[model samples]
Target chain A: MMDKIIRDNYQRETKIIDAVYPRTYRDSTIVHSDRLQCVYDVFTYTGDRLNDEGVKMNLMFLHGSGMNRFIWDYYVAHLLDYKLGAAINKIVTLDQVTHGDSSVLNRGKLGVGYDWSDGARDACKVAQKEFYSGLEDNSDDIINIVVGHSMGGFQAMCCGVLLPSLFDFIVTIEPVAYSPNVPNNSNVTVLPPKFFKAIASKVEDEFKNEAEYDKFMHERSFFTKTHPEIFERFKETERINMEDGSIRTKMERRQEMLCYMTLHPTSYWLLDGAKHIKVPVVSLVGGIATWAPKENQQVLQKSIPNYTVDVVPQGDHLMNIEMPDEMLKRLSVHFTKFAKEYQSKNYDNSNKSVARREEIFEEIYKETERNRVKNGKPVLAKL
Target chain B: MMDKIIRDNYQRETKIIDAVYPRTYRDSTIVHSDRLQCVYDVFTYTGDRLNDEGVKMNLMFLHGSGMNRFIWDYYVAHLLDYKLGAAINKIVTLDQVTHGDSSVLNRGKLGVGYDWSDGARDACKVAQKEFYSGLEDNSDDIINIVVGHSMGGFQAMCCGVLLPSLFDFIVTIEPVAYSPNVPNNSNVTVLPPKFFKAIASKVEDEFKNEAEYDKFMHERSFFTKTHPEIFERFKETERINMEDGSIRTKMERRQEMLCYMTLHPTSYWLLDGAKHIKVPVVSLVGGIATWAPKENQQVLQKSIPNYTVDVVPQGDHLMNIEMPDEMLKRLSVHFTKFAKEYQSKNYDNSNKSVARREEIFEEIYKETERNRVKNGKPVLAKL
Candidate 1:
């Protein structure tokens, strides 16, 4: 059902860009010292323009461990239509150094250790060189927003800290920015080794048959409660059949583990950088008591003084998919407010014309109204 | 940071129960009926267990039009942990009628007007009944909670209204339960229809190719922005290759319209039913300012006199997934308070041996400590 909705509601174009270096190794020299070569996949809405500017918010999504940028596809669709017939900006998703279609590290070697900071640096390099380049050219006219979820959220924070001048705003959903030496006594931890071993064994057994692995992961992963249409759609895109009729995740498992093991200690770089960030920062925390400890929120609020945290009620780690509407709402408010403030501050008294601004607003209103009628909701229309 | 942590710590178990029906509709009998059938799929941590005598929360996930139950897998995984760790009673998920493995209405006939109330009725008969039966059998020992998102959320409200006795609590994330009728004289009505057609046409063009269609939906759907992981997963599960080499959604498109257009009018059956509900209700409204009109929340709160409406700051319709941890926190506070009150009233006076209860508490404490250690955190040598 969701597929048809997407078909009936959204249009996207995905293009894979080749990275300069095909692989990253612990000892490998940087191919481009100033930039990291990586694949950029942009999902643009070929629908009616939501704004008079015909501009969209460009999100450079960063994937979590063992995953790729593809994780965000589901959420982007629902956001296409705002509750009041408002449309959101476009999204550009990318794979981190060793995940997804991007170049593998150590020539595809499994479990090679990589510095967590380097990954952040690489992400910033991508944003500045690839994502921001376009935005920079249109900085005066575009309303750009940066959105990241989970690890992607972390990367987004890194980007905000590193390139604060480039983005109009930053939004992180359940960002994992744990500081080292923080008290862990009351924190939730992983189960025993035996439990993990059991899980590993099960995974291995399933790996012997790709389809079984797919089924196993499908059932076991945190997606069991998802709507079936979504679940089925995800399974189709995320699972790849192996030669033996078993399905293996497109992402390598060991690399996934490496990403998991790597952690960024509360770095002075991020902390110092965040202090200087000029744009509004909205952090969304899921209320899954287990995933996010109360202390974490306290620590974050304390660490990033300028940050505004919104705790999503009844949300978990995967809050974006579980609650896209909520996430978007928060984002919309922040973006709208930011855009308004930005325009006000940057407005030039001599160059600005009240009549011109009103004219523009009128045009946008007409366009929005037209969209509502064509979409079949002539009632409750927004302009 | 969360991505790495999840990679290191996350493990899940998924199960699918077949032959679940959301609701049944007999064209000759009634325009909208109150029974639905659905498959009940559950996901949980392998070692996690719920409190033996607490209220259990059942999440009845309803997919949007053309979607199935798979969209909620991620939510289930996260909510399952709540049920296990927080002493939640149980979690139940099902495919809506005409979707997933459930029997389709009209045997794949198109353009069936599936009233939203009918969908709600289906939930009442199938999922809600089973949940009530479980709670009723354990009424002296357990409580019941309901969580729903998007269309599923609307069904949750219907269930709350129709079967007020079944749930002790209800949470709806960005539920489009009612949209105020716009005045015809409003300027919004004057917009050109071509604009709406353009938006609709763009959506239609997404289905030109199978892979593109899948990608289009995966990228634009609500899940895309919030729960990217599950979004990817759903895209994989619910798409089929078409004869024209385009991917056709496995779900019937007309069913999607039915889910939206078939909403039950806020009639006496529903409005009066709300007045009779005995449990606390929490409606998590997304503050996107676009999707959910302020009037909708007002109407819901007015209808359910005992309800508590919380506006998720900067949240969209799918607030649950967008900010899972935050949502969890809000829900936990409510549930925990309810649980504590219930326990104090009912179990406080029971003359169970203090020594026995103490021993049980100690055992639980020890288990929790063990779990902390297993998760790779430093543990005090002596608890």
Candidate 2:
């Protein structure tokens, strides 16, 4: 079932990969007892980074909801096809808290408690520690392109807001944001800070074996867009083998919903956050009538100064996973365009700063009240 | 796990359903079949066809690839929410030949031999024998609606062409057609009475037990949009429990590719066939850059006079299986519009014809040559 196109041949050389960012985010609001650290993978090509005259860019791939960094192995392995066997200088991918290997390392405490907003917060921290810090010496000399789908797209936006100059270009594929037109689910958390139980009460959380889960996922319509190996990769990285010899998703059900609940307020923060993005941003709409309201992008385009929208008509929210080639094609074009423009201007690291770091956290919580007053969306508050 | 909204409370009733159209399309030039018939299920509302005052119509739903008639159970079972326990009067759904009970009945002969074109041929024959003949009495007083996804969409076009007057309206969802932009795989099946064996040498065919296959398919991303019972229903109808204690898909892997190959030439036949559709037709694009070429839909819209397109943003080729609500929403809008317009001018069944039935087979082969001469996609002539 493993697609050779995605994980074999030249790919066979750089197959096994994992990175553990040792710094734990101790202040996680939702999972009070849990200690979570960022886990990521760095994919370096068969040869050294293209230092010579060649079209090169660094990539940070952000995965969507309930997905681990390993899901990105498909793109990392296949992006080599964009060129004969090289394009990116360094590829960095990460697992958000309550997801993938990071949660497994947290032991049993990484429960159904982590929120969506915390994911963005943790993502920013990881990018700062793993990627941005690594670029401390070179700084803005190299172009860093962030390609994200779904929740990763949402977190990419947070990364943009937190460190405006870190990523030179960002591509968002089917990231959900606040849409006034979409009716709020009735289970939105109330002010006393009690957690909302899982809406997914009926979802089967465990399978008898690997083939069972594999066949379960393989038959669905969504994976028809994904290469089989990616799911195989996810199965390896994101599911746990229980004591009963059954496999279950790394994300527990209630905690998964809590991720949605915790990050619920940030949807309102997005339009306002659009003002802070100094870099060129591109939004990819998966389909016209998608889960993310088209109006969210419309509102974004209207609010932001430098923004463009790409419509990959054949894609759904998971198009990044569905059609990586088209997604890569878009990223390559954007990188080339931005590199040329920035190169012409002789852009440098002069404008970079840690000054916004303090203000960024304030912005996430500050906007919550403003949004609540405006009846934007229900905001999450601690107990 | 059943989604409460899709299958609970009201869904407990009407558990038994099955209808087999017995007449074999042995004359089908594409399949040279020993015997073949379409298997389908019919769902009648609580009080029969509410012909007295309901928004009366007869609906036929054709499923996508590797699927059978049982998938429609979700839509039929859940439609009660639209009108507090009632909606459409009669709903009919079918399994394409070489699938479901039809394949089971065909025994071992239903192998890589089944072609996609033959599927349309069989569907046309089923509609002719069961639907058209039944309507000989009620005729114009009733409206016939055909809704299909993926290959079903392609076959729906075939149905529209073969019997233009039989169906009053048709809706196509992410249906496969052809475009020169799409790269033909390395194997462009050349033909001259030779059977090209299965290209799927790598596919894992059988599991040790039904539990293994069941648990495997239960975990894939594609089925996220479908209700669990539909899959369970599919397992019941389409998979065979072998005597040696193993489970194999009723659809062999080779038959799937041959479905793509056998009908390869028909992509060129589509534009010409579109000219024959007199009824109002609507095409739903799954996404911008999907497996089904955007140019295919563009060409269809250009060729067909009475046609419209609705872009379902959140869907890929399997949109029918993913977000059925959105699919149904588009259908409802189309039905409402067509009903109001056709109501203004009384339409009748005088054009119904058996005379053209003989010509349908001749036309299939005739178009094959014209398409080949037009430098159509390489067709599998049968090896």
Candidate 3:
């Protein structure tokens, strides 16, 4: 039913742009994908000057479900100013394939190979195509940053591994990284195959009609109790309507299910990728107490040796939306430090460049190792 | 424009019903009044029958805007259990005229005299009507407490004065009582008429078209960002809709304006009312340093000689929603003490109920007074 709705309502249009800002830009396009055949959209901001001495930053933003790119409005607005001021080099953000104006997938889209990693890969492809294309044309220096929240957090980790060269820094907010040792069959961790089968069979049987399907979606969606005001806004921008008066998501339901279902590798893959990378990484975890557990943080810190995690005290999974100023402040601090390090190399033409980088990397590794030890855990193997 | 959208999309057939429990048989009714032209739901849980041996304690609840009686779901679900079983006698809740499935009033439908005072009066009427109806129907006996939050706090204050007989104890959560003499309105108390006009104009402009209006209502209403999940559920329940391709609010814009535009008389009116009321009153103020000035509390304490005020740390206007456990804990403490006094009076015929009640009330009042004096300013009064 969701798939049919997406097919009926999905619409996409793209226009190339000469410039978004800063770098005498050219070749910009917008893509609209369907989630469950509903129209989902993504706006790509491609760099203009490929050979400029600019630090390329790839920002893959993952918005929570029921919201779109508008959640990043403040950040985007700031980026516009940053670009003009040359404060930032370049940025690329996409509506998650299942969320924003992206396409909705079908329920059949679930399983090991079709999970969040696929979504991250899709996002990486978009960034690689845009940034790599710019690099290919102009040879501009590129530094990648991947950021996501909730499901987006899951994707950010996926992208960290799938496109290791593309992202030097990765930040995830409240990533739902369940431990492999913990029972995945629990309702809170992952829906068991039996539960999925029941839900799928029920949806197939009861939601044959668009209205029934839409009603079912509204009823079962995690955001069922969302404020009417917000739900209405989401409806206006995030969903597409069918000719039969039924509605479906623009992103593929299958993609969304794939994002949730394929978590077998755990976030360990991303942690391993982080070990191989030579860039700084940070994660902002909202300490909601009710949702994100301390165990998850412990696991992430244990696996990822070169990552700094800051827990925002009274924040939820949507920390970026709920506490934008705090999130921005922390991000700015990390970025400024990275920028300084990148610039410092120019003044010191010492052969210690590799050694200095290694030293910083070793410092991060030591801190993470100490943390693991203090928390009564085994030391992670160095990359 | 909002007024028109409400008129177009208002659900006239909506009804409120009480959830009856076996232990406590509370009388509940849904009144469809032409004055508001919507359902006014009232739930009255009579005190547990103690064979006229226990004191009657009545708690009148006033929930915040954009929330129905469901906001007190925790109170009903947890607090009212055995923890508070021996402390209180009865609990009563009413859906204010324009809120919940309560009566939806359009502009000019309620007489020109309508305002916050009128809202209080309407709530009092419901309480009294329920009280009398319960008495006639032999629904448990007791009337002693009044609890409200935000706008409900204001209503609770008004009810305290207008219906003094109904409550022997009161709990107000962040009640905004304006003080005309306070310098500069430092507490941001005097919400300028311009603010309301600006919002009204925005609402009017946004709701020009039915579809557009519905969309606008959904995005701008209080329900938008606060609790998206609940809002979606409401939409699914058909309690709210975006059917016209525009957002139509379940609540009338005029009613919302009435809440913000209207202010309780800040001067001697409240003080004098407080003076006339012999009931013990506890005002729970959220320590929203950004929004609440320190001077307001001093003024409030000075005005109500018998009043006890508590400053909840790191709390906001939505304290009930934000810190329900704390609020419930404080309320339970006070109610327990009151219940003990009543029980003592019954057990020992020589015990003076008035003296005992005054003793506890005086202790709370004196403590609050000292805190206010020490803080060096009347914060609540200033606001």
Candidate 4:
């Protein structure tokens, strides 16, 4: 029924975009730029592209760690069938380099570890090529919104910062962003990255068969509350068949562990980089305190100038999978409100004035240069 | 002249105490505990131990990075000669491993990289053995005070947290502690750890002769304002005579680089560990902005419960060497005030009440455990 609804409401196309695997830190000029094909799904609306409000939103969905683009299958279907007051021209979903179909394509070409900024770089490229290729800046009626969960949620915010002009709005659900500045207000303290890495090291790599994998996942509490339909999609897309007919999870355990390890530094970078995001950001956090405390969401609200955090009742980290309807309701309300605001506000005010993000970036770059000491000599000597 | 004053006013003894080289992270129980000899110097006052105000104080001075206990020579001489309205029973100073004479003694036995908490552990063991050993809890008449500069300053705060009962006060001088929570009010943004590591890697490790080393150092602006006598002491004691008649800095360049790399994590750890410190902390910052920003000192002021930041006029990062008189005057005033306050306040109130630090530590430990997921199974499963 869900597949039929999705098939009838939208025209789906599997597309691949060129992406670069960055080598240097902070996306510095020194990059290998290993050309890889990043696979994504695009769903174009068959009905009226513009809603009653006469506004169109083009959204790109990004999955979290160890998950694939198909995790959004249920949510996308609901959005396409029930526009929920906001019109959608198209919806896009991505599979990260080492997850799902992208994992198979970039099997041996993957980098040693994940540089989170690389994800932002790839997403920016995709958004530019897919949505803004021939459109004039500020002329395109389509509002570009990037919605992501967990790790992808962090990347969505990064996308806004890396290219502030690209994204119009960003929605992150339970982003694994931790800031040292904020106190953990949950009942328990969040464990450090090392502990998560240790747990990742021990994740089940392979199963005898799909049924066995299903049984194993069902036993784990992390996926117990996942909607049955979403669970089926996750089980099908999150793993691949082995040569011997067994199955293995798409994301390598080592890669997952590496992702967990990079969480701290990358999260801190996001906290520092968030101030540059000139777009509105709304974070949908789980009301139920789980791995990520509710206060963790405040990191974005505190740093970003225009940011809000909404708590989904009885929702957990996997709220998108567990209660897609609740997430959809909040998304529709937020996108409608944001679309009206964007129409009323002078969106071109920033472009006419100084590009504050670029200015701040330049300021930070110069400041870093001035503070550096080279060869036992200070460039601008002080004390 | 300084040597004559120091020799006449105090009875000095070189002491060696046992210390452990921690191997595990966070000084976890899984440690090698490689036994090592930590060396220190004791300067017992020859005059009346108690001040006119009827208070006795025992002082321990810890040197900053790339420095030894001898860095305190001028400061110690001044303190011994002029009591500064306060009396001192004895003054002690330490040479951290890989920095001074201890570097030569512990040659080839040092651990790879630095675990900052190990410094606190060593200092705690030394404090308990030297000052508090055989003394009944809350019965010791001498108020123990620890004064550390830069890296040692950070360690002094750690010392207070690790064993709060040992030290009555902690004074940190332009400590290398940086917290992301504080807005760096200085004109420039401080360079990250990687930049410092690069600088450390390029430092001149070996000098042809003492005169060449002196000439090289004098050419750099970093040491231009250093007091001539203190600069002489620094040049003489900071380096060691090599086997080929050349001179090499006591601390290895690679070790120093590792120390720089560990600064970020260790500083964050200090921010978290600082709340546990029940004693008063005074951070002496340089009025002249140099490598360490004045706002960087505010990290301690914000996190620590009973902490204060004092700016020393015309002083920089190496204020202890550049303006020892200014540092000494502030120390005398702060210490004198602290001593009098300690005498008036109920010093044993915390001991009689709940041990808050231990309770917090246990709470964090249990929280970590509850939040940890082992073998794909959360101990206290949620979501």
On residues B1-383, what C-alpha lDDT tens digit does candidate 3 reach at each position?
22232233322222343211100000001111112422343333333434334444555677765456556545543455334425333445656655555633332223212245445655655555444443322222343567888767766776655444455567788776543321231111233444445655544322435555446437764434333333444443224444554444455554455444334232223433444444667888887733334554665566554688888887776667656667778777767766665456333222224455345434543342232122111111100
Query: Mind listing the fnat for each candidate?
Result: 0.16, 0.00, 0.00, 0.04
Once superposed on the true structure, which residue ranges of model 1 sit more than 4 Å away at CA? A1-11, A16-37, A52-55, A83-89, A103-111, A129-138, A179-206, A227-230, A266-272, A347-383, B1-383
lDDT of 4 at A157: 89
Candidate 3 lDDT tens digits, A330-364 = 77667656655655554321222445544643454
Tens-digit lDDT track of model 4 for B253-325: 5455445444544454455556656688998888875667545665567768798889776777888888888
C-alpha lDDT score of every prediction, in listed order: 0.50, 0.55, 0.47, 0.66
Q: Pairs clashing in candidate 4?
A: none
Best-to-worst ranking by TM-score: 4, 1, 2, 3
- Alpha-carbon DockQ of candidate 3: 0.00
lDDT of 2 at A354: 38
My TM-score estimates for the predictions, one after another, are 0.41, 0.40, 0.36, 0.45
- List the TM values for chain B, per candidate: 0.68, 0.72, 0.63, 0.79
Better of 1 and 3 by TM-score: 1
Q: In model 4, where do residues sit more than 4 Å from their true spots?
A: A25-34, A81-85, A134-138, A179-194, A346-383, B1-383
Q: How does candidate 4 score on lDDT?
A: 0.66
Which window of 10 residues has the lowest lDDT sum in candidate 1 chain B?
A: B25-34
lDDT of 1 at B219: 64
**Candidate 4 chain A, run of 10 with poorest lDDT:** A23-32
Query: Which candidate number would show the highest DockQ if scored against the true structure?
Result: 1
